[model samples]
Target: MNDLHQKELLLKSILENTRAQTQAIEDDELELLETLITRREGIIRQVDKLDQEMARTTPGTSKEPTGPIKELLRQIITIDDANQELMEKSVQDMGKEVEAVKEELRTIRERRRQGESYVPEYGDYREEGVFFDTRE
Candidate 1:
């Protein structure tokens, strides 16, 4: 296969894998998601290099790719968009959870402060003197 075709295939594969990884976010598989994100970043770098190579090889007038390559490019764009949305939603959800935790902490602190100031109705008593007897 030609280099362009190979690059297209690789890009499509990476995009597909990234889409799959985004699904893992819903499952709460954080470790796997982190690994996948790292892999996706590496693949994105590869895609960028390939894009640069294609740009260098192609004529300036023919700015757009044609045929199967074009179609694959469109698919990659759609998948990437979906993955971006998913990631954004995940971040928003995490932000909400963090806010909830902060509010809960604030409530706990307020209650602790209130408790500290509270005093029972009964008065406190103190011993004023101590005596020791040596007779047996």
Candidate 2:
């Protein structure tokens, strides 16, 4: 296929992958998210190769890529930006959750230690004495 067609296809593929990546993150599908990211990287590489080939073939041409290619690129960037925002929020939220869990664990451990303090070191409880008062 021609370079333009190839680039278009690659861009479209990236767009599709980006959308899927967003979905994967939202769904909490780690494996699928990784796969989508890898696929998108490969598509990006292909696009880069096409750009290099084109530049070599047309040394003095300074015209920018236009039409559907431009539009595709714009859409890709917008979606990617949103995806990045989502990922940042996810990471932040995850950190908060981890902190909360850690705090809970600390609280539990502290309570356990405090509770243990109430017990005898020998692990046995004996009455020191019994006191009874009877009045008639």
Candidate 3:
């Protein structure tokens, strides 16, 4: 029972941290995002271990979670969903930006190719006659 409560508090803290990390993702802070993701993964591992322990302790019947636990779970779910949406949007925006850059590079390359093949308007030079051979 006490262990369960402690685990619940830990879970809540992890959820809050995860939520903050998700917000960091939206801000485009990739370094902080990476650190936060690693921390969240560790917390997830802890949560999984606690869940397994709880399952082992209760074998006959499943116990209903407390009201606060339920609420916390709901909040975590909502935040995770929003985070997923933001991540998807960010990926799409990056893809579009990459394509635009590629197109610009192609255009620049084409212009350079054209410039290399350009011919100036000066007339061609040629020798037509020789005048000094008669004196020899």
Give the winner by TM-score: 2
- Report the C-alpha lDDT of model 2 over 1-136, residue by residue, as the tens digit: 8888988988998999999989988887889999999888888888888898999998886658799999999999999999999899899999999999999999999999999999899888777988888887
Roughly what TM-score does model 2 have, to 2 decimal places? Answer: 0.86
- Residues 34-131 of candidate 1 have per-residue lDDT tens digits of 88878878887887787787778875736577887788778777877877788798889999999999999999999988986785536566558878
Worst 10-residue lDDT window, candidate 3: 118-127
Question: Could you arrange the candidates by TM-score from highest to lowest?
Answer: 2, 3, 1
TM-score of each: 0.67, 0.86, 0.78
For model 3 the local lDDT of residue 58 reads 75
Model 1 alpha-carbon miss at residue 12, Å: 2.3
**Candidate 1 Cα misplacement greater than 4 A, ranges:** 51-61, 119-136
lDDT of 3 by residue, 2-88 (tens): 657877887788788877878798789988888888887888788778878878877764566667777888888888888888989
Each model's Cα RMSD = 4.9, 6.0, 4.2
Write out the backbone clash pairs for model 3. Answer: none
Q: List the residue pairs that clash in candidate 1.
A: none
lDDT of each: 0.79, 0.90, 0.82
